[model samples]
Target: MNIQDLRYFHELVNLKSYTKTAEKFGVSQPTITAAVKRLENKLGTTFLIRDQSHKSIIITRVGMQFDEHVQSILNELRIAEEEIKQNESATIPFGLPPIIGRNYFPTLVPTLLDKGILHRLNVIENGSYDLYHLLLDGHINFSMLGLTKVNPEPGIRLKIIKHYPMNIIVSKKHPLAHKKAISFKEIANENFIGLSSDYIHTRALDRMLKQSKISINTIYRSPDVMVVKSLVAQNLGISYLTTLSITKHDDVVSIPLLDANQPEFILAAATRENHIMTAKEEELWDILTK
Candidate 1:
């Protein structure tokens, strides 16, 4: 049966009068009767008891049990409609790692705004670790960040959007600047600038170096990606960052760190495990993938 059929049956159950139920919708009593009949035929079960001689109407014992379930479905439908409207009108809050947000949001957000899918956007800049938890906890709608080798929590889901090559960023004056490529072993003595220790990228780099018994000097650290880049540009140290994090700067150059199969920086979108893409989220995904 259709929504109209369910609506008729719902109202009829509460009113216990087909005529009054039809009156509520400004429809004929026979229309209500036929709607309920259609619903019963579709479900193969009677939902009401009618007294032909006295014109009395009563809900069936089975109807009472099914009414609870029908009411739940109706309530959920109503809630979904309201949420859709709110999603269109309200500012939707989502998250992104600092570098990804900086590199991608300018184009992505405007594209969505131009399409009229999003009214306003709220972005949270965070490390991948925190961003994943935010999604699992339902703190943000969705986020773009890196996922290391470690699997995330049970209720968090990720989809890889793109891969960026991890680059060694250094000042033009630095001796390594002219090199075609560098390896972790060769940079053992170089000072390093990095994302904060809590960031997954930083930790991953730490693990990589530790495995080789090599430790570079970590001279500077910050949660802001710009700071890390700026430090490298000033020759304070070299830093490992994805190509997406690079901006046009005269003082610095990004050179690839060579490895087999071309290791890459992965960027992904995270959402609640089973989040169904509503209009806004679906539009965001489209722009991201394109």
Candidate 2:
């Protein structure tokens, strides 16, 4: 009935000898016998049968069935104990988009180490759609993603950390890089490297391009923002990317799209609405947002 009784029962089945089980558990043989007897009494079923010649123990038919359940219970208890240990050790499972994880997380990693907070960071380079799915399924604790108009489900929350404008990125040697600002219409015929269709930025870019009657000859589609930038630098194609994506790259020049109607990317922190963030995560969030 109790965890101790279950543990005794599980060990008794494994060792197949009450004397051996007691020795392993640092208890007397009589104590093991009494505990197993008590468990059998509570369940109204005998768990073991004694061999007449050697006085060894053999599991009864009923005990075989109960053993499976007891093993499951013991396994669950072990998992619970492990989870508590991990929590006590200050290990947190965090999820983030790869771009953000690689670019910005390095700044906070040492800070977390200094505080003795260990992070099991889950990096996913997939677009926002996959990240949202992972968060909703409780596979990830939190994510930073491009802002979209979709509403979060109940118990999920979102905070706008910063507004990022989408910029047209080109290699310094590219002709369009000379223009301080270029209209979408001007670049309509240009070859483009773009985010995959699932990305919000990609959708936004497609919408703006459509409205301007601009047709992009998309040469590459990727989820990695760095890849997009690198390809552009090679003069393979030009692409539109958020300022965050190009912040560290000097070889690429990001020119603002001149149209007043051009859409801006909003970088937001997303978490379960009612779920609490650890003190360290909250601190990191504050520092990053500031």
Off by over 4 Å in 2: 1-91, 118-125, 148-151, 276-290
**CA lDDT, every prediction?**
0.76, 0.75
Residue 253 displacement (Å), model 2:
1.6
**Model 1 backbone overlap count:** 0
RMSD each, Å: 12.2, 10.3
Encode model 1's per-residue lDDT on 40-139: one tens digit a residue.
8888998898988889888998888878888877865764564466467675567777777678667776687787855656777777788776665555
lDDT winner among the candidates?
1
lDDT of candidate 2 over 1-290, digit per residue (tens): 67888888888888898878898989898888888899889989898988979979889989989989988777656644644554565654455666566655676677666655544443555567778776665555567777545467876778877777888999888888889898888887889888887678878887887789768898879877778888888888788877876766457889998887777777777776644566766775565465
C-alpha lDDT of candidate 2 relative to the true structure: 0.75
In model 1, the Cα lDDT at residue 139 comes to 59
- Residue 98, candidate 1: alpha-carbon lDDT: 71
